[model samples]
Target: MGFLQPNLPQLDLESWRRGTRNERMRPLVAHLCEVGFGTPDVVYLFYVVKIGLYLLGAMAFAVATAGVDGLFSVGDWWSEPIVFQKLVLWTMLFEVLGLGCGFGPLNLRFLPPLGSFLYWLRPGTIRLPPSPALVPGTGGRMQGTVRGPVDVVLYAALLGTLLVALLADGTRSSGDLPGAAGLLPVWLVALPLVLLGVIGLRDKTVFLAARSEVYAAIAVTFLFSGVDMVVGAKLVMLVIWWGAAVSKLNGHFPFVVQAMMSNSPVWRWRRLKHRFHRSFPDDLRPSGLSRALAHGGTAVELSVPLVLVVSSGGWVTAVAATVMIAFHLNIISSIPMGVPLEWNVFMILAILVLFVDKAAYGVGDLSGEGVLVLAVPIGSAVLVVLGNLYPERISFLPGMRYYAGNWDTTVWCFTPSGLDKFDAGTVKAAMLPHQQLERIYGEAEAEVPLFTGYAFRAMHTHGRAHFALVPRACGESHDDDYLVLDGELVAGVVLGWNFGDGHLHDERLVAALQERCGFEPGELRVIVLDAQPIHRPTQSYRLVDAATGELERGTVLVADMVVRQPWDTDLPITVTPAPQVEC
Candidate 1:
C-alpha cells in the first residue's frame, strides 16, 4: 500500500475490468494483506476526536446528576447509583443518535455518516418487525418499508422520552451508600423502557440499533432499589462477559482475531500483521498466534469477571479491574470495523463503576435479595443459550455474543436492474453502494474501494461459503451478471440502521425486496448463513430466489471453511434443493 494513496491494483484499466470478480480482486487482496483497508491517518484522528467528545459528553451528564461535581472528581460520586444509571441512559442516547457503532467511512457510511435516528424519526421510513406472521396486527406486508405515521410518532416519542429520563434528577433511595445519590425516579426510567419495548415490538431495528439489549437490561436494574440495584447491574455485566466468551468457542473466532489484528491501526508493522495468517497466498488460515490470542482472550472474559464479582476491594479488585480496563482499551485501540467504539467505552466505565468502585456488592450481597435477584441473570443466560442454538430467532445483541466473529451473515447478488429497483423502491438515507462509490471516486476509480470491500469480506471464513453458494443460487446464469453486496450494507440502506446483525435481512427481507422491486425470478438471489451453534461444527445456509422463493437449504462445514484462504472459492457445499411450486 502507498504512503498517501491506497496502493491501486497494478494493472491496465481494460485488463483490470476484464477479469472476473475474484480474479480482479487478487491484487486488491494482496494490497489488503499488506496494509488492511489502509484507512487514512485523518480518519483515525477523526475517531480519536469523536471518542473524546463522547467521553466529555458523559462527564457533563455525570455533573448534571445531583451528587456529581467536576469530571476529575468522579471519585466522590463514581459509586453513586444515579451516576451509573445516567451513564447507561447517556450512552444509549449516543448510540441511538447514530453517533455510535456503524458510523463513518469505515463502515462505508459516507454521505451522512449515520442512519439510526435519521431513519427512525422519518414517517415514510422502513421499520423491520421480526416475524410479522407470528404476531397479530403486524401482518400487513413483510416488506421493510411498512412504517405508518403512528410508528414514526411512537419512535420519536421513545427517543424524546429517553432524553427526558436521562436528564431527570434522582430521587432519594433507601440504599446504604453515604454521600452517593439515589436512583433516577422509577417512572422516569420506566416510561422510556416501556416505550422502548413497545417500539421494539413494532420494529427490532430501532431496538438493536439503540443497543437496547445492553442498555435496556441495565435499565431493568433501576427498577430494583438499594443494594439490589447494584447487584442487578453486576449480574448484567457478568452475563455480557461470560455469554460472549461461551459464544466464541467455535472454529470461526480465531479467523476473526486474525483479521481484526491485521486491520488494527495500533498494530502497524506489516510483518507482525502477516504473522496472524499462515501464509500470504497459499494458506490463509489463522496462525498459531491468532489461536492463542483467541483462547487467552476468551479465558480472560470468562474467568476474570468472577474474580471481580467475588473480591471485596483491595489488591484482587484493583488487579482485576486494571486487567479488564486494559482489555477493553486494547479493543478500543484496535478500531475494529463497525466502529463499536462507544460500546467499549461504556464497558470500561462499567468496570470502574460496578466492579471496582462499589466492590462491596459481591455474590454474598445478593443473599439479602429476593428470587427476582437470581431470575434476571438466569433469564439472560437462557436467552444466550437459545440464541446460540437458534440464531434465526434471536438478535445477537440480546444473545450477548459481541465480536465472536461467528455471526449470522448474508450476501445479496443483484443484477444491475435489480440494483436500480432497490434504489427506486427504498426510503434511502444514501445512494446505493455502487452509486455512492461512483459519486465519490469516479466510475473508473470506484473499483478500488469496491473490490477492497470484497477482499475484506473474503478475509473471513463466511466469505468462502457465501461465494460457494453463489453458483447454486445463480444456477445457469453467469456470476458477473449480479453485483454482489453485503447484506449489512443493504440493511443500512433499507432498514435505516444495521450493526452486523443478519436478523435484519433474512428470508423475510427477501420477501420485502420482491414485493417492492418485483424482480424476475433470476434477477436477485440471496445467501443467508446462520452462526454455528456452540455444540456443532457445521453452520446452516439458505439460498432464496427473490421472485420464486427459496431454492435450497443446507449446511456448510466449519471444518472445511477454517482451512482455506478468504479468496478460495472452491469450498465444498451440501444442498437440499427445494421442489419449486409456483406461487
Candidate 2:
C-alpha cells in the first residue's frame, strides 16, 4: 500500500510538469530571483545623487574664491602644472561637498520617497514591536552574514582595476586622443571609486575609518593650500604697488611726482618692517632645555612644514608657510598634547622689530637715527605710566566681601552646633555650659581680633565672607565665625566659606543659626541651602546646592550634622523636616 502511494505522487508530479503554467513561467521566475539576490539598485541611486551634490558644492566654492583675490591667486608664475591644479580643485570640491553633507542637512532630500512610503505602508515597519529578530544582536548577526558576499565582490573589483592600471603602458595610449595618456585620468577617478567601494562594503568599520581619513586629509590640504594662497596673494599685491609707482613716474603730472617722492621713505620703512617681522620677530624666545626636550619628542611637529616651505621657495615662501603652521598648531593645541605656535612667533616678531628700524635706517642719517634712538625710551615711559596707574597686584582677600554682597539669604545652616545645644543627652550632662562653650566657640574668639583685621578688610572691599580659619584657631571656632558672618550676626564678615578651610563644624554652625535666625533646637523643617561662589569685583553669587549630603534624603530630622569637604558646589540640596522632641 505504501509503495502504491509513492508511485501515485510520482504520477502527479509528472502531470504537473507537463502542464502549460509551469512551462510558461519558469524563466521569468528565475530572472526575478537572480535580480533580487545580486543587484543593489538603491545604493547606486544614492551614489549618483551624492556626486551631483558634490559638483554643485564645488562650483559654489570656486565662485566664492574668485571674489576673494587673497584666496585663489595664481601669481605671476605658476609652479604646478595645469593638470595638477585641476586635480587639486576637484579634490577640494569633493572635500567641501563631503563636509557639507556630514554637517549640514543638504543630503537628506536624496532618499527615495517611494521606498519611504512603502516602509510606512507595512504594519511591522510603521509600528515595530519588541521582537527578538528586531533586536540589535539579531540585526548585527544578520548584517555580518550578509556582508561577506558584498565584501568579496567589492575587493575583487578593486584589485582587478588596480592591477590593470599598474600594468598598462603609459607611453602607448590604447584609447582615443592618440599619443596622449588617457590612463592618468582613469587612474585618478578609479582611486576614489575603489576607496568608496571598500568603505561601502565594510559598513560600520569602513564608516569610522573613512570619516577619520577624510577629516585628516582635508585638514592637511587646507594648511598647505592656505600657505600657497597667501604667498601668491602677497606677490600679486607687491607687483600691483610697483606698477602704480612706475605709472606715476612715467606720467607728466607734477602732483603725482611730488606725492610719490614724499611717501617714498615711509613706504620703504613699512616694507622693511613687514619683511623683518614676517621672517623673525623682535622677541624671539628660544626653547630652553626643558622645552626643547618636550618638543623634541615630536620631531616632525615643526620640521615637516619647514621642509615643505623651503622646498617650495625659501624665506619668502616660509612666511606664508609659517602662518599655516601656526594655524595647524593652534588646532592641535585645542585637542591635547600640543602647544600653540602663535605666541612663539609673536615673540620672534617683537625681537625683530627692535632692530629692524635701526638696520633699515643707518646711523649716519640724523633724522632716522634720532627716531630709532627715541623709540625705546618713549615706549618705556608710556608703559611705566600705565603700569603705575593700574597696578596688577591688587589683593584678592580684601576684595572678597565686596564681591559677595548680602550674606544672610544666601547662607545655609547644616550643622548641629548651629542648632540648640542644651537638649542633647550624656555629652550635654558631662560637659555643661563650659564644655559646650569650648566646643562651639573654640580658640577662634581669642584669635578673632587678629584674623578679623584682615577678614574685615577683605569683607568690606569684596562684599563676601572669607570662610578660611585663622591660624592657631580651633576648627569649631572657625565654623562658628563663618556661620555668624554668613547668618548676618557679624556686621562685616563675608557670608561664604571655602569648604577646604574646615568651616563646617556642627556645634558652631548650630550656635550661629540659633543666635542669628532664632531656630530652636530639635525643630525640623525643610531648608534650602545655596552653594554659589562669590566672584571678586562683581558682588554676585554663582549659587549651586549640595548634591549628596544629609540634605539629599528629601526628609530627615537634624539627627547629626557633620562638615565634609566641598568638591562640587552647584549640586541640588533637599532637606526633610525633623520630628520635634522635648528638651
Candidate 1 lDDT over residue span 168-284, tens digit each = 777867366544666788888888888888877778888887888788887888777667777887888888889999999888788788878878878888888788878865566
Every model: Cα RMSD to truth: 2.2, 34.1
TM-scores across all candidates? Answer: 0.95, 0.19
lDDT of 2 at 155: 36
State candidate 2's TM-score. Answer: 0.19
Best by lDDT: 1
lDDT of 2: 0.25
